[model samples]
Target: MSSDNPTPTPGGPTRRPSLDETGELPRFLDSATSDEPIGNVKPEGDLAGRRFPLTTGFSALVRNRHALSTLIRRDLAVKYQATVMGYFWSLLEPLGMAFIYFFVFGIVMGANDKDVVPGSDASFVLYIVSGVFVWQWFSAAVTQAANSLGGQSALITVMKVPREVFPISVVFARFAEYLAGFPIIIIIAATFGHGVFGWNLLWILPAILLQAMTLVGIGFMLAAGNVLVRDIQRFLPLVMRMLFYGSAILFTMDRVSDSGLGQKLPWVTYLYEHNPLVVLFQMHRAVWIPGLAPDQVGIMSATFFAVIMMFLGRWVFYKLEPRVLKAL
Candidate 1:
């Protein structure tokens, strides 16, 4: 080698990335910026920070199930640690709500005397409690999930675990609370009217599973989205409140399905019947009460909706992940 053209040494100044290699100078600069905080992610290459497929994300969750469990436990402990009643607070909340709704709608509104559901002897109390249980699980999982990522900014910055685990963990933890409260529903069913055990009772398992899957999907989307838009956190509670009224928590689906409203607004009735959470709630109510069987079509529809939401949430989460990290 000539003196003017020295051979490249083992240790030398790093070469600046070429346009072909970096793709865009601004992106390269953003990546190079020292002020950007280190997070659970480290981006590189052409596909760095790109969206992952649903299968890939789910498999990652399955593979990291232990970490997910730990997160779930930690979340539960932290949430109730300060409270005197601890986890029992979960049962108490819905119990209190059940009483209030039972008094207002069941007594004052004369739901106690009427069969809110056709062909069943279940009172309005039984009807409302059943729906309230489902709502508690669904609403808690989803609302907490919306804050899962943003609330754990410290963990996001330090933990190298799969990001999806945070939101899914919230779902699992709230599910534990749901399970603890399930006995109350069973006791109410047996004490208030019919016995809880029956052939149709087997259907509650699938109903719960389908609802969990749907919530997981919502969790993924909301968790990722809330990281970017704090407005999502503020807006979710109002949405959940609206869902409570619209989901037939206080009334019977049959009323709307067979009423003048149904005749005039057939499309509205269709939407309500097909609403996945509505289906799940009605399925829960049916299996708990005597003389009713869950609508097989509703169960099937809920399953399909859950599958679709899972796909949608996974797609949206991965799509927004790169930007979410930056926003957080």
Candidate 2:
């Protein structure tokens, strides 16, 4: 080599990134005017960003089921852990609520005027219990989803996993707890001999699918909002309370027919059909209670709403996720 050949430094440069003595090696063409990365390992820059589409989001959510399921189980454990009895409270919640509704609707006002009685033929309890079952699940999902982000602030602030997963998992956790009471519902309906049976009973399955979709969508949206607005957690219960009475849970929608204003009410029918949660309640009644349930229109409407709620809610959640950590 010629004497002019470049001499290597005796003590080489440190492994850390920096400008060379001549500021030449590994330098960019626009180094003087740019803030672009000059290191081998640049920041991922808002890693875990939301650039994926709806399908990808859902697929990712599904893949994270273990994390989701753990949260759900933890919630259930925490819920009963504070109470006197543990799992028994699950059945007690609906049963206690059912008794209250029974007194108010069935006994207090003599409101079981439609002969909505329970027997080997057709049970009123089953009709009412079906409503309780579906409503509890829907309400749980909604209520939990709304508070999910706020509740998981610690996890959100520290964890590397998806942020949306926290709220979505909360919804699922509540759902799993809500479902724990279902076998009791089915048994009550079956024991009285007033149950509807056979292949037709399967129709409730579709309504359930619709209801689940609706809950997930609404859950994500509520969870996102709850993170930003602390008041939402308190306000959501009030909203669900009103919805419970208006949702046609204890009594049939036909019960409103005697009052012309409620009967002639056009939107009532629309809400009944379009709200997937309501539709699931009515669907369970239609399949479980023999010779009851007016028509299938409500279930159809609910299915439609479920589809709309799911897509829109998911979009909103994805849109909000990037800012969620900051808000939390």
Return the TM-score for candidate 2, rounded to 2 decimals.
0.75
Q: In model 1, which residue pairs have backbone atoms overlapping below 3 Å? A: none
Residue 321 lDDT in candidate 1:
84
lDDT of 1 by residue, 1-328 (tens): 2222334546896355433344332221223322334444544454354422222467767766776776787788888879998999999998899889989877787765356655556767778887787788899899999999898774554444567888889998988988899888888778865545777787677877888889989999999999888899889889999998888888876678778989899998988787777877877777776444546677688889999998899899888887877666
Candidate 2's residue-wise lDDT over 195-278, tens digit each? 767765876777567777888888878888877777888888899999998777877655654456656786766555445555
Residue 286 in candidate 2, Cα distance off native in Å: 2.1
Clashes of 1: 0
Q: Report RMSD for candidate 1.
A: 12.8
Model 1: weakest 10-residue lDDT segment is 25-34
Which has the greatest TM-score?
1
**Can you tell me which runs of candidate 1 are displaced by over 4 Å?**
1-56, 258-260, 290-294
lDDT of all predictions, in order shown?
0.75, 0.65
Error of 2 at 228 (Å): 1.6
